[model samples]
Target: MSHLLRAEYGPRGRSAGASTWHVVRAADPATALCGRTMDTDAETRAEEEWGTGLRCCQQCGSLYMHEVPHMEGSHPYS
Candidate 1:
């Protein structure tokens, strides 16, 4: 089944490569800011850089995010 995901822009931190993009489950798109449930590790990706925010999956109550474009491939963080 297709799930509704929300993308929020995270600010850069004091450390380098700390900026991230968060993707959370929109349980109540009209009212829910993040999600009502927590995600199991199995449902999350290892490469995701988590910050302060809530995420959930409709099917498993899980959440994950993709690595920043510059952090992936051969481009290194400077």
Candidate 2:
């Protein structure tokens, strides 16, 4: 698996705050690993893993969890 990048895109529905984070690539900025396209220029990127509260792309989440692992003592849950 390749290195995973987490980014947030907004306006999911009626609420402007309704944004979903997804796994994307540095090469393909507009496309998520789950195959959704968003305006990459407007997206806010997460440091490493995605934020906790924002919803995640199911497919991308599954793929990301497997691709990028939390090193021992690195994450809160670890």
Candidate 3:
């Protein structure tokens, strides 16, 4: 289950990292691994660039963990 790094912007300041990075399956941009509808127009980033410090979607991180257990600690921005 390959995932792509993208962005999910919600209400302004109405979230805990809601405007952070999101994870979407490489095959689909319709919805993210966190179950949030993704913005198809959003540009996706390479998995290598999903490093720390950036805001990341928690739900996506959880789901991604199950998707790739070996890649633990790879999901940044928790």
Which candidate number has the best lDDT?
3
Better of 1 and 2 by lDDT: 2
lDDT by residue for model 1 (13-62), tens: 32333232224433433321233333222133222333434343322232
Query: RMSD (Cα, Å) of candidate 3?
Result: 7.2
**Per-residue accuracy of model 2 over 1-78 as CA lDDT, tens digit each:** 344444464547424543667777677767777887756655455536564656777888786667666565887766
Query: Which ranges of candidate 2 are over 4 A from the true structure?
Result: 1-15, 47-51, 72-78
- Candidate 1's C-alpha runs over 4 A off are 12-27, 30-78
* lDDT for each candidate structure: 0.32, 0.63, 0.73
**How far out, in Å, is residue 49 in model 1?**
18
Better model by TM-score: candidate 1 vs candidate 3 = 3
Assess the local accuracy of residue 55 in candidate 1 as a C-alpha lDDT between 0 and 100: 43
Candidate 1, which ten residues in sequence have the lowest lDDT sum?
38-47
Of the pair 2 and 3, which is ahead by lDDT? 3
Candidate 3 lDDT tens digits, 1-78: 677888776676334434678888889966888788887876677655555666778888788767766655766854
